[model samples]
Target: MLEDLKARNPHIAIYPVSDARFSKYGKVLDGFDFNQCLDIMQTRPIPEEGNCYVASDAELMGTDVAGELSRRFYAGMPVQIGYCNGNSSKLNALEYHKGSEVDVAVTDLVLLLSDIRNISHNELSSESVEAFFLPANTACELYATTLHFAPCKTSSDGYKSIIVLPAGTNAGLDSIPAPKCEEDYLLWMQNKWLIAHAESIPASKGAFVGITGDNIEINY
Candidate 1:
């Protein structure tokens, strides 16, 4: 895929995260210290305005979505036993840890709702940018401190990842309120809080600091 990206000259990385193994407790093998980011699939509607934005800071931008490939294709899940992929709809949303920048990804299904359309990718040879349409139920982990885009999730069951980045790291901006013309279009927020720099990672000054079962102040 990397070669394909290079041949296509998109100047992007399409690394499919090889399953690094899940922990005994079943959490996906956690390692990167990059800032975490995620959002819950909006399950309910705004009680105040039936069609308008609610004032609550927590009003979500999501809906019921799940893997559409489960019925027909080999929606692989490396972490599971029987199938390559699990009930991805049951997978958790995007997440980032403290001290890391959040990486957002997105896709468009409303564009494919009719099943007769094709996603448009504007490819180039220079270091420009491109968008993605993560087939529903697909989740990816960006390498530590890697620059990526606001992810596009079309699963009605919702899709996301919680990120954990270096302390004091600058993360990309919230993707909910992208510019009017940019809405519904997957974009790599180049200047937001989600993007991070080497200086922002945990100071490799003394020892390593990691999260424990309960507390966070402990240092290793």
Candidate 2:
């Protein structure tokens, strides 16, 4: 599957999550049973047009593994279990949270990732991004400084992935606070800092236009 994806999208390099190149951004997780959660996610519908992101879902969180995730994966930190299902294929934007994020790929997908250190004056060049492939049923943890967004689909079936994060990470903010630094401009929701490409939907909604260069599209 990885080879097929590579052949289909020859213009960009897509490394598997197991590759050393992925270590700096995140690590492939092991030893946690995601069967129940993934089974539930498989039943959720993917949006016909764009992405459907639920920051919190009771059904997913009700799985028996949820308690274990909180105790082990998150070390007792309160967390939320949600899902992002979509047909996205572009590097529309990048977002980071105050804490690490865990993703469980329900289907094969691609992720565009970069380091927060690459940001210069609150702006990041699309050139700094790297593509990584997440095979079906794989789980990985993305560090707090790792910049990421929606998983790009590798097939017409679209993508489905479980999103685990500190509770309230992407919940709406009641009010906007005065900006104290350039990074403040990128704060779009609670614990979520976003940098959007000029052509992205977030940009049209007034998210900080911080991504420059091409809005990369995955041909596969």
Candidate 3:
């Protein structure tokens, strides 16, 4: 399936986490016990077609890993535990926040990434996007400048990963002050400024839809 994907999208190349390009943005976490988090994921139901779950702050009352992450990685910055599990392939949108995000891959998956600095006028060229392969049972920190969204499944079983971020990263944005500029169009959610491809589902939901180029889809 990977070979087929490459054949169709020459620009799309999946790199291992150890690649130097990844070093500039994130790193793999060694010696972390992800069993407890994976156990909780096994209890939830992941979607078959697209990303379906996201708890912006599951750590508040969810798992012990959250506290561990805060103390060890977040410097006690009141982190939150969340999860994104689904069977998705398209690069629908790209979003970023004020700080780094840690992702524990309970299952093998592919993450689409791009440097937020490449975006201009609230729009980003798809040509700048890249794909990175995240192996199962590994955790990595994605820096704030990295634009990313859901993990694409590498197989039919689908993908499941634990997401760690600052508290209230994805909370409701109904109370945010009104948009004042073009960049504000990307503020669909709190702490998340998004640029969605026109063909993406979020575009229909009134997302900024500032991404230009084909809506990338990974072959499974």
Candidate 4:
């Protein structure tokens, strides 16, 4: 059942989730016309986790031909296809401070060399993996496990550095010093509930590049 989630490589194109109905800060527009834009891919969490820790300098995960990572215990890391395309909008600027106490992150882009060590996760084993987002060419990071806002669109060439946090049981993050969302963040918060799920498919069809092994070297 898990293996069926993947599609052929050629058909895969990471699409920008332009949710016109939902608010950018992840609030449901009551009585607004809402239709989940299908035909892209359905982001399913292979070894999905709602709440988990994010170690500093984490990279978005990918897969090998043998398909072992997604099939094994290491498959549930972030997926880095490329950088976030069309890179500039107020919403595009998901800021990251040096050190913060939080959990959960979803990446808009892969982390570059610099911000890699500057960031960190709670390292929660069997805990709610945080979701996060890091931006390209910028020197910042979102608070780990802090639900600032997300669904950042990746560029055709992919982004250089971006980071998110593991999911946690914090309700809406009003207490913590949450990261600041760009002015119009509510627009992209189309599928907040769905985004929290570990094993959601990307909407349409594409290659499922999941983690393969412990070695982070791209043999491809």
**Each prediction's Cα RMSD?**
19.4, 0.8, 2.3, 20.2
Q: Candidate 2 lDDT, tens digit per residue, 1-220?
A: 7899888887789999989999999999897889999999878999999999999899988988788889988899888999999999999999999899999999999999999999999889999999999999999999999999999999998999999998889999998799999888899999999999999999999999989999989867
Q: TM-score per candidate, in order?
A: 0.24, 0.98, 0.90, 0.19
lDDT of each: 0.23, 0.93, 0.82, 0.22
Model 2's alpha-carbon lDDT is 0.93
| Best-to-worst TM-score order | 2, 3, 1, 4
lDDT of candidate 3 over 1-220, digit per residue (tens): 4455456556688888878989866888885677888777777677756677676535323577777877888788887777888988889999999899989888888889999898998889888888888888889999998999888888778888888888888888776568798777788777888899999888998888888987888776
**Model 4 lDDT per residue over 1-220, tens place:** 1112112112222211122211221221122111121101123121221212222321232224112322331246322221122222112112222223211112234211112222223111111222223322222322322333223223332222222223222114233223354222221221121111112222122212121212111110
Name the candidate that leads on lDDT: 2
Better of 2 and 4 by lDDT: 2
Best by TM-score: 2
Please tell me which model should have the higher TM-score, number 1 or number 2.
Answer: 2
Ten contiguous residues with the weakest lDDT in model 2: 4-13
- What's model 3's overall lDDT? 0.82
> Which runs in model 2 stand beyond 4 Å of their true positions?
none
Task: Order the candidate numbers by lDDT, best to worst.
Answer: 2, 3, 1, 4
- Comparing 1 with 4 on TM-score, the higher-scoring candidate is 1
Better of 1 and 3 by TM-score: 3
